[model samples]
Target chain A: MATVRIVITLKPGVLDAQGQAVHQGLRALGYETVSGVRVGKCIEITVPDQTARDDIDAMCERFLANPLIEEWRIERDQDRDGTGRSRVPVLPRSQGS
Target chain B: MMRFGIVIFPASNCDRDCVHVLRTVLGHDVEEVWHEAGSLDGVDAVVLPGGFAYGDYLRAGAVAARAPVMTAVRAFARAGGPVLGVCNGFQILLEAGLLPGAMLRNDVLRFRCTTVHVRVESTQTPFTRSLRDGQVLRMPIAHGEGNYFAPGAMLAAIEEAGQVVFRYCDAQGRVLPDANPNGSIRNVAGVCNPAGNVVGLMPHPERASEELLGSDDGRLLFESAVMWLETRKRSLVTPLRGSR
Candidate 1:
């Protein structure tokens, strides 16, 4: 099973200081195909099935993302047993390269 | 005779200011405690002064918050001791997991250096014993990452719990829309834990402790903390009102 999510950002705050310059360049080139733009960062994580939510949360706070400006969400892979309900599957799923 | 400890780190630049305020203005023998080790041998309260610890190389206060002495500081604060963190110190407190919310780059994307008025929100908390509701004080704020952020539910909960300590304001003490340099939510400049033992702010209160230096309004914060220590640590030191 695979749990998929997307975390997107434009690097850090200072990374986009040239935003205005780029926007102006686009206008001068006759592209006229751009509007307001901002940036952020993105990350993808896979956690263990036995891992507690609190432990994973702590890991996120300490390492995966900068606590100051980064925001993230977690989604667990669900596998159905041919039933009407969905249940989280075991993580670290076996996959072949 | 309350002994206070002013926490010092490699990038802490305001330790002396805190010491001067504690000893000269608030009348306490303030000790400079280093972060490389834990030895708060004789201290009633811990003050984390403002500075760019670790050059804020990572997140502001992220690296310094994990220093050895923070263990003891955390233990002490958890056991109902008072801990005050100003500016970079505030960043440390948040990174140390002592306080909620996080600070990011100022919304305006610039380092702000200016003096602003603030209104004291609560005098009942130990950290605000010397202040009254709506009392205004002018304090200096200098920071690049002072925008405070938390989720909506948590923000409401913090407000409902009376944790707000100060806000950017006009001369009349009304929070000014134009005065919010960082576009901080709700014009918040400072806040305390629900228990009121841990405080964090973006301004330099100790720098305003003396009339000769500049404004003396910030002295009230040191006074309030000292008063709180006297009331809470009666076993360690006898209380004094002004002088004999």
Candidate 2:
């Protein structure tokens, strides 16, 4: 089985109210060093075989995310082996930091 | 007689309310159209009432916007049929690309259900023809994702075209930050398409259509649509006053 991962997040300029609440909660818990937090959704889908990149892109663009306010990318575990894992770029640090 | 079609998607809570106001109270011919349907026959106007369609799975109105019925709605609007979307309906309109911009969670991250004062910014659209510019209407807004946002360029363009139909303002029509229930950019509460045939607002006009329920400012919207239809029928030529 091929496992596909889709990560969806709001665009940089769009406001993220839930993420901001999380940031505030972390600060209240004494995590002063953590300056920012932007929560996002990670969806996993298991397909019978390797899913085509075009299909995945369509899924993201059509149903997985709102193109107007969100950005999404897909990750595929093709080999099902640990070594073949794809790396994702980390979110940038908060402006205050 | 003017006929209005109300779309009823799964999990839609305000379909009945819209029907009650449009048919029972306002005495207009109304029909409930299912979301999966492909046609809107014999309808002069269309309404997408507020509700949590598809349980707001991906996003408010995101799933419903792709439903088959919206295809007909889009076509209807493209042909100059007046379309009004309220609350969740507004979100669906944005998702369907029938209108510009998007909706974000409320700035306070809470579900706000309250009567907000909205000032009509334009009387050009079929939906707002009954009200004068700068008229303040008391309407109830009940939603978590009512904060409206658009890119700077899009915002400026809509504002310049006078497509901004309504804005949250004080009793005296003062638009202040504190008066904004949601952090909608520039205190915008509603907007219309450039053609002035389609309008979407994050407030429930149906809920405020009767005085017993509170304010009847919303009734003017329905009356305006009916009047527009009647006027069109009499003239046989659309009396569209201005150009975008």
- Candidate with top TM-score is 2
lDDT of 2 by residue, B52-127 (tens): 9999988899999999999999999988889999998999999998988889999988889998999999998898
User: lDDT tens string, model 1, A1-97?
Assistant: 2433334343444234235455667789887777855554444456556766577567667855555456555544443344522455556758898
Question: What is residue B16's positional error in candidate 1, in angstroms?
Answer: 1.5
DockQ top scorer: 2
In candidate 1 the C-alpha lDDT for residue A5 amounts to: 35
lDDT of 1 by residue, B114-231 (tens): 8988888766555677788999998899988888776577778878877778888888988888878777678888887766778888889898888887799888887787777776
Q: Kindly report which residue stretches of model 2 are placed more than 4 angstroms away from their true locations once superposed.
A: A46-52, A78-97, B236-244
Candidate 2 chain B worst ten-residue window by lDDT: B235-244
Pairs with steric clashes in candidate 2: none
Positional deviation of residue B70's Cα in model 1 after best superposition, in angstroms: 1.2
The C-alpha stretches of model 1 lying farther than 4 A from their native spots are A1-58, A64-69, A72-97, B235-244
